[model samples]
Target chain A: MSTPTETETPSETETEGGTRLSYETRDRLYHLALYGSAALFSAVILFPIYWMVQNAFTDSQTVITEFSWLPSPETVTLDNFSVLAAGAVPRYVINTIVVTAGTIVVVVGVSLVAGYGMARFRFRYKESFAQFLLLGYMFSPIVLGLPLYLIWSEIGLLNAQIGLVIALSSISMPFAVWLMWKYIQTIPESMEESAWIAGASRWRTFWDVVVPQTKPAIVACALFAFAIAWNDFTFAQILLPSQESTTFAPGIMRLIDQGGYTSWGDIMAVSLLMTVPPLLFAYFLQEYLLKGFEVRTR
Target chain B: MTVHIDNMTRVFDSPNADRIVAVDELSLTIEDGEFLTLVGPSGCGKTTTLRCVAGLDTPTAGTIRVDDRDVTELPPQQRDVALLFQDIALYPHMSVRKNMEYGLKIAGVPEDERREHVAEAAALLQIGDQLDKMPASLSGGQQQRVALGRSLVRDPSVFLFDEPMSDLDAKLKRELRPVVQRITDEIGCPVLYVTHDQEEAMTMSDRIAIMDDGELQQAGSPKEVYSEPINDFVGEFIGQPAMEFFDAHVESANGTAAVSMGDHTVSLPATADELEGYVDSPVRVGVRPQQIGIGDPAEGIEAEHVLDEPLGDETHSIFETEFGDVTVVTHADFDGDGDTEYGLVLDESATQLFDPDSGVRIH
Candidate 1:
């Protein structure tokens, strides 16, 4: 194949140079248009984040009086960050981290075992059980919020980080289980059988073989669980409303509602601060997240 | 270890259809160090039987014993059996060494001993140089060898293979068959292998058990099963191009019996006395492709030439006979044009007779 192409190159080049020049120009223009559209789409998606970061760097006075389309480095100040650093921001950050981490631990651990069970075992009403989990996922979190709040209060878990963690995890569980079950189905059951025949117990087979094979899905699930817990405002607002116990979402809301005037710089700083962890998580998990959908058994 | 399976059955119940009896009441024993193969068509329950033996699947009602110890209720790990899968399920994340050592590690074998066993098995498989590479990086044949090595390092009492070479190309499958045979022989364990390929079963097993529709049809040596199949299904299924069947009526006169098909009559051999009761009644006659010879055009049963398939060493001449299309293996040098008539002579001793109603071989 290559030999024919090599031999044909010289005569073809002499006869087709003009036509090839036009074709190459058209190809260049087509690629230019394609890249132009992609750049436009990316800018449209990232502009708001850019604006937020710019606002975070500006002082309160400049943000309120001299709002600009482009960032002006001369007016940039660390006052907003310093102000946030000195206040309840650190506590709220810690609370958010704890709730997110706790939600991930509970969701990933429970979903993995449940997902493996649903994927590998033949049990009564297994399909109905999977449908039920999906139904829970389809219901709006707000609908379950009031009932969950009441239950937490009755159980003396109100105003606690653990309560917040539980509430967020409940919301995340159904989707996590659904994702994990679908991912685990792609893995061949023979791998587990081989492990078992190799003298590994069921638990050992799960941790040693299944877990490593399904790591991409687990990481993707953990990131999603973390995102849900970190961004939840309604649950935190209802379940743990106290100043010290509240998460960043509700805490930031409280910061805005408590004053006579809106502090633009402080709000921007806090919002920017709150976005960092999820952004970092998504950045680091991007590779595995892509792989999670395309996972196949070797 | 000798493995005994008694009255084993497996049924799969689903909401959409009738409960499927995947494996009927099947019983057999594999003597110590014997290599037995379960050969059948797709849905024949051979794989299910192997799974039950490996304890990967539990039989509905039966006891499976290894060395006289009941392992019916034990999990696969406790059964002390090694099962190699058709898909070569080596851990993708692990290197060849790690995959082979995994079982020993689970058994709490010390690191030094695990390494030694892995090295020994790798050397035996000629995979010592590839031990550090991951499974995904290996070729299909190499991966299969690693899977075999993984099972071999454990030194289990019984070995079960589920069509382990089904995924390989023809050349690779041919090359690996003897390697597997040699390895199983060296291991000196009772082995139960399952495959739908009859040629593999014929060449590799000490005894071949044929199954159909979840029922065990026959269990015997390859020659016994091939030459003396208990039923028509086994006779038809055990050969390539399969055994050709002719609808014929048996007639006996003056103590001489013959089968008549269309205008041709082939005399039955003396061994067919068991079929004498079916005289004047319809019976199915089977003749293996290799047993049908092309003689002088005027001397034997007449058939119209359909096509000739030259397969290097021999040519299978397909002919349109009164009994339908029949394939006969002839010498490679034998040349016959299509649309011409030829004489097909059936070897009397090799002819098979089966009852038409039940498909049971008469003699």
Candidate 2:
């Protein structure tokens, strides 16, 4: 299927005129090139993921001795997963879920109202305020971490899941607000005016009308906030140094840094476990992500 | 239900430009059950005035009173008015039933009563079967009906239509204009419609208020504004083919008034006797195209025929007269050859005389 047949090159005159090649041969070649490149890119991207899964299934003894690309069925074992289920991995997973969920709730709530105000209301220094928000988004978390830690410690929130949640929300808030403001601006002002003329108060209009209309953007913002808080290692490591309070990302790093080469399978198994929730969440919410990009009125 | 706008003004200040006075000291009264239309060219402050009435745009000064209650300081939700936007601003996410019932729900009407009101309004609009459908699924005309239904269910004290029919096709617009009129009539509420289309203003409004540069030009019935315009702008802004103006000198001799232009002089009617004091002064004579009559070549002022535009029922003959270019709308059966000369007579009763400098009507 990769090589062109003899009949495929029968269109020299058509090619010279800049017209299309013969239908059957052209279709075959075009599809072959498109699908071949697609498969190649998929393999390139998915190979690391496949390797992680293979390492997670292999026994610790086999992983230490063999360097084969494929895992043999006889050597595949559930010992690494059993160790993870029985260890602190469960507690770390719960901590990650709590921090990520809290971060998403706070980020989505505050940013939605702030974004709506920025997009709809006319205020003094509006442009300057928006620029200030963009600056917050542009600044790296590393730059803001020391001050945040000091403030959390002063407030007696250090080493607490709520403290981690608040820190993650602050990092994700500006991006969430920027996304929401851009989305809400696409809604015509007439829709709000219509609600107003329908006898709805401002609060009712915001909740009943603007909220429902911006559902897709809200879902996308939630997913983004989730990803930010779920994958954060730096903030969790700095703010939560206690062994029992840390999230999965820093916990996995701590396990890998224990200086033992025979525990590779356990590390791979935990990493694979950490990737599952986000993949499932994104897969289920792919529809809303697509809809978020469509900002037309009707 | 009377809407009294007292010396209302709206000024908008842009970041990059000076303040724009959108509605300047505009005052009007819409009586109960009367349909008044604000008509003008684009950027003429008609929509601004309508928005002010709807409480969508706040006025810089003055007060708006509906049924003797001053609502200028109130928000749109507090004012008992329904505004049908130009885009037919239906809540796209809601079903038709939900859209119509929203206002009632917000007003704290009982559920059963809300359902009844929605049903009644939907039936009135003939959209009962489409209640469950979303606005995106409906056609343009259907969407317009749904918008009207939403407003109708509110039973507002006033209805503000912001060119709601402008988005529909010509046939649909024609079909829906009377439906709008009938609904407003049934509701017996004052309606203030805004549109830049003169024809819609003339056909749909009980009284038309013409505006230009954020100032009211004139407010009168369509016939009064068309036949006896207060100024040159009103004269030119109304009617098809437009009114034509000729720069002429007013001459009063032998106890009679006449206007002289170039080599021709046409006698003015007795109603123009007010111009006697201004005899021999330059004045602008206005005449509608339909008011000009073609006569025998030997009888009246001579004009050379330039072209003929044959409409279905009448043919408008463009002639090169001493008045520059004049259009005469004659019956369809009337025949005249292009390039030939003919005599023209102005309908003395329809002739409008204006001060040449100020463009204000003399009588």
Candidate 3:
């Protein structure tokens, strides 16, 4: 209940009368240690990203050398990217973009209406429906892979873009619901009520007042979905493996498989290629991204 | 311009479809251009009544008429009303121009008129420069003006203000009140302002309608309500220092009418001739803090000073008198103790008396 003396009036209490030399030494030591560890940790975290780009330019000749962290003159080249691009891989990038875009549309659009319903309206099984949607998040997707493959195969949706869309979207919906619910809760109920009284229809209030205020959250939700759908390898590998339907993830894995493990340049290049879409989306939406996480309260 | 509500009621039925009446079967008429405030404590149905009139929520059983036309089943837009909410719900993503432009667009105003109106409201509110800025970029007061501008573009006939100034600091509230007064005056429409803060109601409304426990307790002009409250609730709800209430009895001291408390007699003005026969009945006396001046300790009825609040201009001194602990506002300051001997003299014109049991104010 009581604030500490140091926090109450720090200048007066930080060091009564004078700073101890030993304490200053300890403090400087702590600062050095913190920045040092942070720098080391940042390098460790970004190493894979750095290695991906590094490996992309390096050819198969030197990738398996003890030089994972460096580029060797004998093995560094653009041949892997050229080889990948020469085939149907570029087409697969288009397919991946199509599938991810499709998934984002369904995920964002459905979650928005569903989130608003679960947040503001009254209906039968409202709570239970929300729970039912959330139930999709309970288990690992690997467990359902077999059944999903069989279902899609039986439905004749296997090896199609729509199959990838449905697969990735179903995986992303529960998360979308949960985040959207939390985001919508932050907008005070009075805000929508005000719109109601301000002569906006129920639907108008959603579009005019609620949706505008929620843009930051919605964009952040899109970013989350984009990340999930883009990086997804399992469903794309399992559901769409036909010649024309292969996505970026499955295409990259197949390239690495055929080109042997030493083609570090190809592997790393594809990894870095996948990172650019999210990195670009996040870079452009940096402001909303910050705002989305900032909890709003009335 | 006129508002008529008959048998209005709203029941909250979620937890148990067993109804909890927020606004009970209430009915009233508001004259054209009347700045009537629905004032009460929280959960007192004041806001609910305003919401019903605004068509934000449908009443369980009732009809609402605005300007002689039924709007009970109509939604807010169809009812021709605009509400300035407590949160000032301006869209954060849009510039102030777009924010105000939305209502006009919805109302089917032409682009030229919408632009002209947005500019006019912005300039009228002195927020012309903020038109290009998003709502998040403006200060709270400016954002509120944008909300007002949005409503102004709609040009609705009825203005509903739901505690619009409740979120601002005291200083900003004081600054914004006169601006609101100017805008409402220029528009001259029927206005329903809802607030639990009686000070705002007293300052902003032409008539203050006091709501309590899902019922209308009393309604009158601010001055009339202050001078002649219908009950203890109205008296207590209105006034700055609030009316001091005391449980006493009407008595005739040998042919002279007076109220006696523990050997002390308040010889009320003889104009109160109606209480001539009500001699032995217990009564409640209400007096405003402003009406009583603390005189010389030896000249008037004695009391003790309990506490004093200096509100810059006038000092509110609470004194424990024989009748009750009374509030007195004065410019002078003095240190006093328990039974420190303070005299009291009432401006009988401003004091009210009520029935002790029923709390009905008696003239």
Ranking by TM-score: 1, 2, 3
What TM-score would every model get versus the actual structure?
A: 0.91, 0.91, 0.88
Model 3 C-alpha lDDT per residue in residues B112-206, reported as the tens digit of each score: 98899989988889999988887777889888888888877777788889999899999889888888887777678888899998989999889
- By summed lDDT, the worst window of 10 consecutive residues in model 1 chain B runs over B268-277
List the pairs of residues colliding in candidate 1. Answer: none
Model 1 Cα lDDT, one tens digit per residue, B170-270: 99999899989888988899999999999999999999999999999999999999999999999999988799888888876334468787677888764
Per candidate, the number of residue pairs that clash is 0, 0, 2
Model 1 residue B214 lDDT score: 95
Scanning candidate 1 chain A in windows of ten residues, the lowest lDDT window is A1-10
Clashing pairs in 2: none
Per-candidate local distance difference test: 0.87, 0.87, 0.79
lDDT of 3 by residue, A91-206 (tens): 77888899989999988888888788778777888778878887887777677677899999999999889988988888888878777777787777877776666556789888
Where does candidate 2 chain A have its weakest 10-residue lDDT segment? A1-10
Cα-lDDT of candidate 2:
0.87
Give the per-residue lDDT of model 2 (tens digit) for B12-89: 999899999999999999999999999889888999899988888899999999977999988898898989989988
Can you list each candidate's DockQ? 0.69, 0.68, 0.44
Ranking by DockQ: 1, 2, 3
DockQ of 1: 0.69
Stretches of candidate 3 exceeding 4 Å from the true structure: A1-52, A62-69, A124-128, A194-199, A259-265, A282-288, A291-298, B14-19, B253-255, B269-273, B295-301, B311-313, B322-324, B331-339, B347-350
